[model samples]
Target: MAIGTLDAAAAYGRSLKTLAPAIGESTAATEQHAGGGNSFGSMIETMVSDAAGSLRTAEAESAKQVAGKGDMIDVVTAIGAAETALDTVVAVRDRVVSAYSEIMRMQI
Candidate 1:
């Protein structure tokens, strides 16, 4: 990866952290008062599904490019982004499952 790209990725990750609190606040408010059917878990599931779909699309596009229609760099970048997003979702799922199991095992 180019140095500039690495820097940009780092900046984007930092920006995401800054947005986290706002997202959490909005979610909390919605849960408490919106009366909507949306829950945090459902939102997370939707995000995961979207990410997976994006990954599949990226892969398909990349494959098509190998047949000589798309730009290699764009395809590679899309695949990388999708892979990273999937990895993040899996890590979050593992952590949530582990925490639930631990809570279940606690003596109350």
Candidate 2:
């Protein structure tokens, strides 16, 4: 069966909802800590951990498929979700690096 655009969009929305709590918590912590550097570091650490978890989940689903015990649809969905999570993490890392570079080039 072919998936519709709405179905894909809903899946994306669900994934965003899953990440929303972490984002909110990180924001709150950053606000509470003000100039403390650990808040941003912890947020990035959490994101990387979440991405690693997604990749591990996808690997497990693929292994199940290889063992003939899992549905192809589930494998596909898990892989897609993992890919999206990894991409988000990489994008964030790139942005952070770019910002750091810009800061380093600024006049002190």
Candidate 3:
């Protein structure tokens, strides 16, 4: 009988080795934020807030431009930035949910 060169245990061990740094960083972050409840929640909230603020600024600038007191470039930039931020947040949320679903499907 011929033996395959691939070793499942070795492959698993290599994967663990590759993930060691990430696991350590996560552990450190958890310890650092032990008092805070869900750092990711706060991060998402902050991102949404920033996007909302950008949209508000763009709205104000548009009103000012209508009144002949604002720059067209600034208004366009603010709106574009806000749109990008909102899109990014939605993409991140989708990816996170997808990853969670995949993890949940994995058998322990």
Assess candidate 3 and give its lDDT: 0.65
Predictions in order: lDDT? 0.65, 0.70, 0.65
Please, what are the lDDT tens digits per residue for candidate 2 over residues 28-81?
544444333455544555566677789899999999999999999999999999
Q: Model 3 over residues 9-87: C-alpha lDDT tens digits?
A: 2343344435646677566554433333466544555566676678788889899999999999988998898788768
What is residue 26's positional error in candidate 1, in angstroms?
Answer: 23
TM-score of each: 0.60, 0.64, 0.59
Over 4 Å off, model 3: 1-38
- C-alpha lDDT (0 to 100) for residue 60 of candidate 1: 85
Model 1 residue runs over 4 Å out of place are: 1-38
Model 2 misplaced regions, further than 4 Å: 1-38
> Best to worst by lDDT, what's the order?
2, 3, 1
The residue-by-residue lDDT of candidate 1 on 1-108, one tens digit each, is: 455322443454444445646667576554433332355544454556667677888988888898898988889888888988878767766787799999999999
Kindly report which residue pairs in candidate 3 clash with one another: none
Which is better, 1 or 2, measured by lDDT?
Answer: 2
